[model samples]
Target: MNRRHFLQLLATLGVAGCWGSYKAYATTSSAKARVLIIGGGAAGLSMAARLNSVLETPDITLIDPSNEQFYQPGFTMIAGGIYSPDEVKKPQSACIPSGVKWVKEKVVSIDPVTSKVKASDGNTYVYDFLVLTPGLQMNFDQVEGISRSTLGVGNAHCMYDYQGAQNTWKALQEFSQKGGAGVFTNTFTKLKCGGAPKKITMLTDDYCRRNKTRDKISVTYYNASKDLFDTPYYAGRLEEIFKERDLNICPQHRLTGVDTASKKV
Candidate 1:
């Protein structure tokens, strides 16, 4: 079943866990299973929660260095000025489900042969079951002439991180107020969300239109692939939207080099 349908069924059945699923435990031996989870992101937290709810006696340890856990999907909303920074920000302690131990540290290295992981604090963790849900990494250094130092300096902005999204919102507001050419492009690297840039671009255009400055400013979108979307059905609709909105679309224009001095990508 689809996720929506599954969730509806869960709600209907009144399942006991957060998403509507109950737990069943039988009294037997005092045996317990050791579960070691890497990364405290969404996937890892979900796995930990589910296992904690189901397992009779589970020793679950979740490892991550960050104290603040962010809801990254809401970043686009922040960039679009639909949400504030506080809305997407949350304490990591709030997401840890029942019976899961939180280790506030980074993992230095992992040894699969010995089923052990070394933490930054010079401690080793040995596990019986390992779940690795480390999220994807952003390679800001991959772009030429642009380092972490130059972000949010000028009209240029990025929504990949929390501060970047807030800065992007400000930059977009400034650009929307002042008439100028607004250019946005995507990278060829595997990103967390492929449509995030496009969504922000469309939102910016809409914002400009609402402010009555859209006619003075030009918006252009550059994509790494030739197609707007992988599926033909959605691609055709997106192309139609581009035509209707008079938005410029440049296909197969991946970002290779950047002139950070001029704020050109």
Candidate 2:
């Protein structure tokens, strides 16, 4: 759905006060069903909001470590030098519903039998229902000879996070000045946003062209996917753009390792 339609749906659903009835469910002596949500990311918060709207005063608790709520899609723009760090970040308090209890802690372990979760802060919470929305973990170490520290410093970099996006912007700026070839690689992992990798690459290419250093710098895209884009229509458009710009595209090549010393990604 488009942004306007989505916002209209949210408004129609009374998202703001939808959780008032859920609070009643918590206070009612009938069952006192406790709902525990793991992870305060988009999925977790969205689930919490919807449940609150359906049930009256529902007993729900959201657990997460970070205090800031990030709009991940904006990271691509940040890497493109279109947005600042502050513009993409929001206080967690602002995104979370008012009635739900916000727990600032990390989940250490889950005892499914007892319906309890242990936190890193030496506390445990019990729940009648559990929702797991903790986002997937990125294993940069899986790449041979590449450490987590190699990103943004060495030849390797990714724009998956805010800090990483900022680092990518810096890397692009530096690369523009030095006029060297760079490789942007994307694996076939289940990433949050599939289009983000190419978006950043295209933005970097645009940046180089704008700075009149396009000839000095060559950006190659190594995507593990079978096609540049999944959808046929979008793929055709991308193919046309790539051909028009003469951007190097490598399809179906997975990233194995980064040769930092040789700068061969």
Candidate 3:
């Protein structure tokens, strides 16, 4: 069944718990609890907002080292030339909800037994409740011959970071004009947005098509799993679309390293 029909079925069975069906029941609490939240990203900030709405006198303190907040989902669109770098970031101070304390410090260590957290500023914070929402980290060192500094150096670009996204946009423009082979890959491990690799690959294909250079450009997609998408409903359709678009799909292959000197992976 299609997604819409499946969701309809869920609603009929009274199990539809989608975001659209969610209703917030805001009620202020009298407890003056000190809540310490680690990280200032979307998850942390959103949680703080919810708590602030539900607590009459919220004592929420958010700790993060970054001075700027990034809209990470926009990175892929930025690489696709749809969003500029400036549009994806804003000062972290502007994102922190009012009535919430912002601690501009990196968390060094957490001592759960003592209910305290040691920050980089050589200060310890005590909290009645702790919320950890620290985001994921990208380890370029794990991949041999490719480091963060080497991105965009040899047509090697990624959309996971701000600079990398801009570099990818630059490389894509050159590639679209030069009309060469383009390869897209994904890791075997779970990603924050696992469909990003496929999305960017399709975006490149679309971009080349719009530029009227698709025929000269060969597109190959390497996936580390057995299927392009784990969901059978969409996987079958995606494979069909890839075939129709002349996009090569190779499954069960993981990219371990890159040989930028010889243009090999």
**Top model by lDDT, which number?**
3
lDDT of each: 0.80, 0.80, 0.84
Q: Which model, 1 or 3, shows the larger TM-score? A: 3
Candidate 2 structure, TM-score to reference: 0.84
Rank by TM-score (best first) = 3, 1, 2
Residue-by-residue lDDT tens digits, candidate 1, 70-186: 999999999999999999988999999967999999999999999899999999999876768899988777877665657765556789899999999998898888778888888
By TM-score, who's the top model here? 3
- Judged by whole-model lDDT over C-alpha atoms, candidate 2 comes out at 0.80
TM-score of each: 0.87, 0.84, 0.90
- Of candidate 2, the 10-residue stretch with the lowest lDDT total is 22-31
Q: Predict model 1's lDDT versus the native.
A: 0.80
Candidate 2 lDDT by residue in tens digits, 21-73: 43443331222457789999898999788766545557889999889999999
Clashing pairs in 1: 15-20, 15-21, 16-21, 16-22
